[model samples]
Target: MSSQSLEQRLLRAWYGKAAWLWLLRPLSALYCRVAARRRHAYLSGERDQWQPPVPLIVVGNITVGGTGKTPMVLWLIEFLRAQGYRVGVISRGYGAKPPHFPWMVSATDDPAVCGDEPSLLVRRCGVPLVIDPDRPAAARHLLASADVDLIISDDGLQHYALGRTVELVMLDHERGLGNARCLPEGPLREPAERLESVDLVVRNGAPGDSSNGFSMQLLPQTLINLATGERIAAVRWPGPRQVTAMAGIGNPQRFFRTLESLAFTFDTRIFPDHAHYDASILESLPGDRPVLMTEKDAVKCAGLAQVNWWYLSVEAHLSETFEAALLNLLSVPHSEKIEQE
Candidate 1:
């Protein structure tokens, strides 16, 4: 068993203690002030810079962590590709074991360098991905290098300096807004009311009581095996076997509950979102048991994983109107901003 108990995990996740972690809101204000000034200068044309060739559609959320942004990003990439649009992606590459600067992510790139999600995107979508601390710089690099028609930011809702044409917000069904307050006070990034202005708001998991956004539900019972490329029925996995399920995602409870609903009796191991695991940890878990995990973790653990490890993949279900709204927004040509001589 890990040092942290299941109770502690719940406390950290939905207990709303982190909602109060924003006790440093004064400090957050200072950070935003500096950020806003830099962005204002750029938007006001006082800062002369070359804009990226194609339009950028930023899919991000205000609340920190676990709003289903990655799945939505992948969904958008697939949707746009099917529409005959060439897309590229840029990310801050959070949770990489070793730090990195703006660089391209290839199928061969290690997850420790490119981060788990970016690596997964490259492997699954086979599209160009840039990992960088400076997102604007990464976007510029993608524009100059890849022959992409559209650029989608994986998660950068607060990065106003990058200049985006469209914004998508994702809300968690279980924790819409803990206490409805800001950091150190609540779980909101800006405010719940901010959703009214975004281009699209996707309620991830189940539909909550929030207004001004589209409802989205994620069905998690689908099991995928990377080892044999075979799809196994999730219903058969539930039983008295000594099974251990591991997840290092924004929301592990969702995974646990989905498995439980399928009647799987197993012990659970939860890690921080994006926690890097070495071979030693995988070797230490009890039993020759079957281990279940998320797709994001599977990509990183592929080589280290044993034959019994399986990953549950989930897809976002959006109303047809949501897709139409997205295409309608893209259909409008980007209005060129006038530059002063």
Candidate 2:
């Protein structure tokens, strides 16, 4: 009926039916050509690079949204911290209201100001998270004050100007670069073949054995109270019930399926990636029902303190071999890393 409704319907249908959209590749290639020219000019010294003090590892996807980058970033942060590396995070602060310039995220900062994802990261992870359009600038600010050693961008695979050391590309096992095309043509930010060029490829969930890249499994559904930090055993919510589950995430159906698998029946409401939720939308849902959402949305729904909500936290389990390989890459001398790149 409307543009928003059309987008929602597409998302609901596209994940399982990628081949139908693959026909758009010719147009996607054309868009890539124009984008590549701009990228080449910038890389060839015709444009200035925004460099950060510390090495940056970009966790991103070719598709527009929901390849599980946030969980992957969370995994990396925890893994690096376990390895004794001081780390800070930076995000572009997508979908903030009254969009402000680079600012450090605090519990007090409105999600309307710093964005939902950045605010969630700051609150849940307890790491210094800065919101800025220029990721390099935000990374610099965090590095200068926090004494951090490395920077992990939430998503910046295409933001090549902010120089990075290693790039980890994430793919949704179910969606696998829908139509394998670029914006307006399909869903890819770059061609599917670009996966071969990245340092590492991560497929979230069981991508099925194809004798290909490494795989990371997402932990089963679990609930964490947004306010109390208390965990409710997932089994506590028995199904065939009318709970209200809201997801304003990159892919809402993935979350809906997750809730279903956990036996929590829902009247599902799917919002666009980074959708800003106001009072009215939250108020429209069944008020008496238990409300649930992805961790990303919980950050934005902070003001809905009156509503009972739990964040379904997903944990990433990267293989030991992948970890070892990544460590080896990181261990290489900077000179060697540059040479390898």
Worst 10 residues of 1 by lDDT: 332-341
lDDT of every predicted structure (CA atoms)? 0.74, 0.76
Residue-level lDDT of model 2, residues 185-228, one tens digit each, is 67667767778778888888754424456688877556777667
Clashes of each: 5, 0
lDDT of 1 by residue, 245-312 (tens): 88888777777887787777778887777777888767766557788888998887888867678888
State which candidate has the highest TM-score: 2
Measured by lDDT, the strongest candidate is: 2
What lDDT, from 0 to 1, does candidate 1 have?
0.74
- Candidate 2 TM-score versus the reference: 0.89
Q: Which ten residues in a row have the lowest lDDT in candidate 2?
A: 1-10
Stretches of candidate 2 off by over 4 Å are 1-6, 10-27, 97-100, 207-211, 226-230, 236-241
Clashes of 1: 5
